[model samples]
Target: MRDLVAPALASLVCLAILIGLGVWQLERKAWKEALIDRIVARSRIDPPAPLPAFDAFDPARDEFERVRVHGRFLNDKETLVHGLAPGDTPGRALQGYYVITPLRLDDGRIVLVNRGFVPTELKEVARRAAGQVEGEATVTGMLRQSEVRAMFVPAPNPQTGEWFNRDVPGIAAAKGLATAGPSGVAPYLIEADQTPNPGGWPKGGQLRVDLPNNHLQYAFTWFGLALCLVGVFTAFALRRLRGETGNGETGENPASATATPPRP
Candidate 1:
């Protein structure tokens, strides 16, 4: 009994921690599922709603809500976000840049639109001269929040026109974009839909709503390890307790002393 005390207590503590981690993963799974559903639902709305006032939009609640805005493209002010072409592209996937062009609204405010992916070969604006839209245009797409910079992501250099993430404010400031109305540039970005451009370059419709959800698999792994831990500890305790009991019995009934071992 004494020999099992330390291991028993330690096993109990380990069990608690393992179970806690499993529960946390389950919670994360539920959250990710809900978010994916929301994105799908919002993006499918017919005739996207008109853009609301800058102050009226809520980043926490309005992400992925499809909206339409009328504006003119500032084509020369394009910023290229380094990324890979979508797997659904016409041919083999190629390394490319997402042409993030600014749309100046009638109200004089600027909204950055992720026009879509363009291959490295057509990187120069001159190469794809036909796609550079002119005059007033209407863009219908999903609203998205800005991406956060991770530790490993390289910061954008002033000289380079490339970026790693969809950082709204950072791009706006660098491109010298602002608004005629209050709040300056819009807080969020508009991920344009797959509407064809005149010259068929800088293809539209590049929003990725679905994200990877593997929390369930991770939860199973943790729980399985915890079960193995219990089985091992149980076998150890049983063997140890049985050995101690047998030693005691043999010591009391030694062959030389018979039953007079403890009478003194």
Candidate 2:
């Protein structure tokens, strides 16, 4: 009984934890599915609509929405972020950098636009100067929310003008738009369309919406582990019970057996 106590308690605790993890994964699966659906539906909208007023911008409600804006590219203040370009072969990716340039809207507000991927050799502004459009331009693309940096993401180096994540606020602050009043800057970014640029160094339409849905697999793994633990605990308990029953039936008294042997 004493030996069984510790094992039983530990098994129960482990089982509960596994079940909790399984449930959590299931919930995450549902959320991911819904998010994918929303993104797909929004991406399919044809003839992109003009973006809403800057004052009405909502990251959560407007993310992934197809929008067009008339603005002038502030190419000098562009920030290049480390990125990868899709390769011709499946599952292959090419090293590159994304050109994030701020667009000065006609309404006197600024919005960051990810013009797209440029090869490592074309990373320098001078190398891709031909693609940089001067004067007024119309940008048609998808509106995206600011990306939160993950724990593993490295911090951006302001002096070097290199960034790891698409942190909109951080970029705006680093680019001297932080103090730009309420009507000064938009809180989101626009991923430019596939329209060809002049020099064609920085290719557009590089947005990849491939979100891996592995929650189902995770749920199955957790549930499977719980089932195996239950089987092991049941087997251990049954074997202990059988041993106790056999001992009682044989009337095996350890104290008497030893005392009699000592007297003889």
Candidate 3:
């Protein structure tokens, strides 16, 4: 019994850990589901609030927020990135590049506005220069976070007017603006709502808010595995215990029979 103590204790500890992991997965599932629900609710709200001032805007709370803004396109500072979708990503198709321009706000700050997708044929630097829409425009769109992925190249040459991805800091520096300081450019990007522009480039209004939360399934899998392991170990332990009992009974029976002697 004493020898079995250590092994049994170890087995119990392992079982507890497996159970704890299963519980943690369940909690994670719940959290993910709630997050999805919140996003869906925000996306479908009847009317969104007006765009906040640059001085008061906060990306973490305001990203994807639909609002109205008054600004003029700083077309000269536009940067074109390769492998972008021009609006409507119905099927995973790579059709064009994202022609992103900065909107000069009332304050000295700037907002990088993703004017929308333009086909590869229209991505030429000359074509872009010809497509500038100057003057003040009232645009209604969702505030967005910048999409910064791993760089295909070490550093982008903004001067070349070619970009691998939309890098706010690099693009800002290239635009002859100080890349630092509290009153500098906004951190995130903007996706304008389907507001039309003079140029034939795709209009904004391409908002897709899809979230996936399958924590329940994950929790079930983890718990199921833990139960299976416990069941297998229990069966093996019972089989060993039964075998020992049977051997002991047989040994006692023979001794008792001999003690009864040949007296039939």
| Best first by TM-score, ranked | 1, 2, 3
Which digits, one per residue and each the tens of the lDDT, describe model 2 over residues 1-264? Answer: 787999999999999999999999999999999998888777767877777666677766777888888989998889989988888999999898999999998878888999999988898787778988999999988998778888998988988887999988888999888543468777788999898988986788988677899999999999999999999999878878666553446335667655335565
Maximum-lDDT candidate: 2
Ranking under lDDT, best-scoring first? 2, 1, 3
Q: Which stretches of candidate 1 lie over 4 Å from their true place?
A: 87-92, 179-183, 244-264
What's the lDDT for all of these models? 0.84, 0.86, 0.69
Tens digits of per-residue lDDT, candidate 1, 1-264, equal 797899899999999999899999999999999988987888887878777567677776788889999989998889999878656657767788888899988987888899988989998888998988899999999998778978999888747776888898889888887732355788788989989987998888876776999999989988998999899998877777666454445233455664546775
Cα-lDDT of candidate 2: 0.86
Decoy 3 TM-score against native:
0.75
Query: Top model by TM-score, which number?
Result: 1
Which residue segments of model 3 deviate by more than 4 Å? 1-4, 44-47, 53-57, 84-91, 125-131, 151-155, 178-183, 244-264
**lDDT minimum window of 10 residues, candidate 3:** 246-255
* lDDT tens digits, residue span 1-264, model 3: 454577678778887887888899888877877776766665554576665554566765676676666788887777877654533566666567777888877766677887777778887757655457778876667777656767365456666777777777677788886554446787766777767666656545555676666767777877787788788767656755555553444223454554546776
TM-score of each: 0.86, 0.82, 0.75
Clashing pairs in 1: 108-180, 193-205, 194-205
The alpha-carbon root-mean-square deviation between model 1 and the true structure, to one decimal in Å, is 4.5
